[model samples]
Target chain A: MFSNDSQIGDFVKSAPKPKNEKERLAALKRLEILDTLPEQSYDDITKIASYVCQAPIALVSLIDGDRQWFKSRVGLDATETPRDIAFCAHAILEEELFYVPDSSKDERFADNPLVTGHPNVAFYAGAPLETAEGHRLGTLCVIDNKPRVFTDEQKDILTMLSRQVTQLLEYRVINENLKRETKIAKTMTRFFENSQDLMCVAGTDGFFKEVSPSFTEVLGYAVSELLGRPFLDFVHKDDIALTIKEVGKLAQGHRTVNFQNRYQTKDGRWLILSWTSSPSADGSTIYAIARDSTVEIQKQNELLKSYEEIKATRAELVRPKEEAIEASNAKSRFLANMSHELRTPMNAILGYSDLLIEEIDSSQPAVIEDVKKIKSAGDHLMRLINEILDLSKVEAGKMGVSRDTFKVAEVIGQVEGLVRSLIGKNQNKLAFDISKAPAAFNTDQEKYKQILINLISNSAKFTKSGNICVRVFEDNAAGVALMVTEISDSGIGIPTDKLESIFSEFSQVDESTTRLYGGTGLGLSICRKFADILGGKLSVKSELGKGSTFTLRLPSLAAKKSKSSSSQAPSKKGSKRAA
Target chain B: MKRVLVIEDNEINQDLIARRLVKKGYKVDFAIDGEKGLQLIESLQPDIVLLDMNLPVMDGWQVAEASKVNPKTKHIPIIALTAHAMAGDREKTLAAGCDEYQSKPIVFDELMKKIEKCLGSV
Candidate 1:
């Protein structure tokens, strides 16, 4: 025993330590077997180790920094022992089997607590368990109460069991890693299958490698049909070039956000898709998410088409209106020029005739009479020219209203004074009734006076030995205050049919009225037009063989000027003639 | 006697106005166009000018503007004899420096009054 202690102590002291003790301990920890209940697989290996070595106790022990922890133990109650006295710790220092004939005889363990205390281990043999990278983590060891020598076969069996232990540890770690990877893959697949957005993986060769189930919902194609097909095959022809360009960018390891394109569906419909894609780090594949934008795109197109149509229609309508206005303006310009030409000669005729009448002697009554007739004829011709020019001015919309404040009675008095002579010549009685009229009002005074003159003259011309009444008063209707002038005559009455027609251009009661009245038939029409320009209305009531009464209703205050008239002046040369 | 210049393009109108002014005891000189009328004004230096608006070579507005700008002819009272009896004629002619405006198909009495008034103002 004295020689055994020194020899075992010498053997233990000469044992080679592992090259990486820290890494070996780390590998044992990675197996997560310390402080655990005995597992049947590990216990079975320990039991086989003991049976082959003919030992009473066996264990699968892991070497920590200061302790040896047993993963499985047979014929032993303690789960751990101090590393200084542990056979497995000593075994882990060697690449093969480590044996001690008697632990009490060994100098290193002669005074050890486990050797002198309960279990009283006397014999030990252990095989170091090594990782694939040569890390000796722990051992499969057998122990006995009596000192013994391990046979070569027993050592070989222990080594085989230790190799199985290493294999089992490697398998357990690989299986756990596989389980974690499968869980993550299952979650990702569920998200892909249930997501509304189209998710896909595409190869750098432009072919679809995988597509989410949402592919069928958005593009109307089965996943089987889309797989292995070039992504451009489903792209609209007009969009394929753009898709290729974007895909090329992806192939260059660029990420594209919101790249839009149109895809043709299986049923021959278009789906507008906005895609965000990123190329894999290796540039061998791309991951993309596509959002459907078909409805928004189509609505934008329809709106653009409608806008174009409306613009075209507006241009079409505006052209003819502008042309008509241009034509009317041209006519007005011609009339103004013509009137100047006509009146220049008329001026000479009238001026010369008055001189002639004055120069003729009173003794030659016959020559005086002839000159008077020429003067009268010239005056009549001037009136006709003036009337024609005035009608043209109103028709061309060149007439504008000029507003001023004037006394009502003053205007009526002037009208009465001007028309009194004609009424006397016709043997008509003229009466004025203007008591209720406003003393003064705001309106186009000249136009009002002209309208009154035309009406009174028409009355006097058609009336002989009859009464002409001029009534001016204020009236209210429809929440508007109006200045009403009624001119009633008791002379040749107009038929009901001719009442409205009389206001038309060059219209008269009949053909005979023009002959008998000696008028250009433009007076009433001019009056009505002037009233309209002043924002008023003119109406006449008459019966056959009775008399005609013409009413002029004018707003007391003028409204805003018409759009064309606001910028325009009254016909430059022809307005006075018309008035 | 007050000398009057009648600037008119038409022969008949010129003759008629010249005869009337002569009968009215005024010496009347006439020109066929505005250029001749301006020339006559320079030489004749008449008391009044009956300027026709539509004249050859230069229009009455240009003639009026020119006459008013000249130191010698600006003093002669001009009565614009216009065939344009429109609303703006008087203001337009007056704005060009005419003393009075009269429309065509002339009433001799009205023209005589305008001439006398212009002569009086000067």
Candidate 2:
């Protein structure tokens, strides 16, 4: 682009550029010598060129894109000049010294401002400053005002000085590269020394050849104690075999990452260390980084132990509950067996006694009377077995309820029939007041009958010639119909403290009451449980030696609401069909 | 004549049942276990069978199911006699094909009434 043909109208004719002008400019720029402060190295060369060439001015001038710049100058007023009139611009194109015998006589410089104006006609010369690669940059040349001729010796001296300037430029590049590398080396050294990880180098001799200062901080060991020692000396005995295998791989130029091992600290505590290692190019040394993982490993172990403990504790908690279920099942089986075994003999005793009574004649009244005693004793024992069986069924939560729509009179008539003989035992007067009783109520008829029979029978046992009244009433006080059968007796009453426990299984008013009154004490508890199954409650009130009233309250559900209507017949047939 | 077969394991209970049955003006046959009871049910073609639950070779439940399925003896009505006081015995025995169930220490009057009812149904 430095064209010589574009200066047609200008008084200052530009010099012709070389064929490789772009590369020549590149070489000049690479020296980085343009417009630089005067260095003593280049200034010494310029001073010598000025004195020996016997010229008034000398400069180490470099050719730039738009100007010729001087690196060092002597007897020079300005540091740079335009490339269009620069004498060094033409010098860069020459292989050796370029000479202008007199500027006024040269076509390129005849109209140049330096020659036509104040500085007047001048003699100029420049030696091409060439790189080792043979691209000429600029020149170290001397200038003198007034036209003069340069001898071959002066051209030779100028050529020699230009080479020295080129050498100085090349030296600057090498100096900068060295400075950059040194800074990087220093930073890398700081990273190795200050890093928290245990950075180390190990030789093939199995010794710790080098270690970062972090190793001392983590292991509680002095640097002197660790260097030159086999690193395996501190490894846990259990992990040494595996650690040796990893190190052997590292020795063969293989990397070892994700390797874990345990090492002993200075105070004889073991710490887990995880490592990443690489082999050197020649495989003579290994570079590795490690972090202490002791706390992390311990926490993992603690979590595993807690999981195991919880599983064991849960199993312990479950065992007793399973055993309790199994025990209850066994008890139920035993009760079933006992019921069969006891009732079978009683059936024979009672049946055979009845047969004998029928077969005996009136002349044998004593024999008939003994047969009657056998039947009566059998009846008492049979009742005790039945009551115990009923209580067992309730306790097992297996007692079935058979609800039906029944007239209140049906159950009351049955209860009155059952308690007739018991009423004769003490001559207890019985009465019924059914004024407010529901006409037809829905509930389990059999269970309700049993409750009434037990209550009246209990009253007959306690009273001697006292009145027992059965009063049935319906109440709608709570927006729901409840049929209450209140049976009160004028009998030897129970104490206040004994009232609650009397309803517990096998509990009586007093321990001697079981002996005095001929009955098992399970009657009341069974009555309460049956009342509960029917969705009702049985409660009692008593004053000592006055009377006791037992209240059995049951829901009088409408037949349409109940599953079994009275039309289904008054029996357990409806409940059986559901089963 | 209405013939009733009484199956009982205990000899005393068997004797007691036979006496009561004979006195009630019905001809009675006796089998000590359920195996004989089933055999007699086919051979004699009794009007009813009183099958006791605790017996050798077969129980009342097995006898009831076997007899009910048999074409030769299926016409006979079975009354299950058991000392087992399970509250669900009525449904349980009926489910096993027995026509009636009565708990033991049998009130002879109640049992006789049940027997007559089963006979009357047939």
Report the C-alpha displacement of residue A287, candidate 1, in angstroms. 5.0
Evaluate chain B of model 1: give its TM-score: 0.96
> How does residue A355 of candidate 2 score in lDDT?
86
Q: lDDT per residue, candidate 1, A133-236, as tens digits?
A: 78887888899989998888888889899999988878877987888889999999999999899999998898999999899987889888899588899998
lDDT at B27, model 2: 93
- Native contact recovery (fnat) for each candidate is 0.32, 0.53
lDDT tens readout by residue for model 2, A1-579: 232444523757777887778988887766666766778998899999999998889988887888888888899878888888888888887787888988877777777777766555398888888888777778888889978878888888888888888888778878877788889988977988999989998886788888899999889888888985789998998998998889889888999887999988898888899999999998889999999988988898899899989989999899889898888767866775686568767777778888888899989999999999998898888888777677767767767775567788877887888789889978779998887798888777777888899889889899999999999999888777899989899999999998889999889988788889877787898899988877888999999999999999888645445445555575667678888
Candidate 2 stretches greater than 4 Å from native: A1-197, A202-207, A214-229, A241-261, A272-397, A402-408, A432-445, A470-485, A533-535, A553-579, B7-12, B31-39, B53-77, B83-85, B91-99, B117-122
Can you tell me which runs of candidate 1 are displaced by over 4 Å? Answer: A1-243, A252-278, A281-446, A471-485, A492-522, A535-545, A551-579, B9-16, B22-25, B31-43, B53-76, B91-97, B116-122
Assess each prediction's global lDDT (C-alpha) against the native. 0.83, 0.84
Clashing residue pairs, backbone N/CA/C < 3 A, model 2: none
Per-residue C-alpha lDDT of model 1 across residues B1-122, encoded as one tens digit per residue: 99999998888878778877897999998888999898888889999999999899999998899999999989999999887565457668999998898887776778999899888878
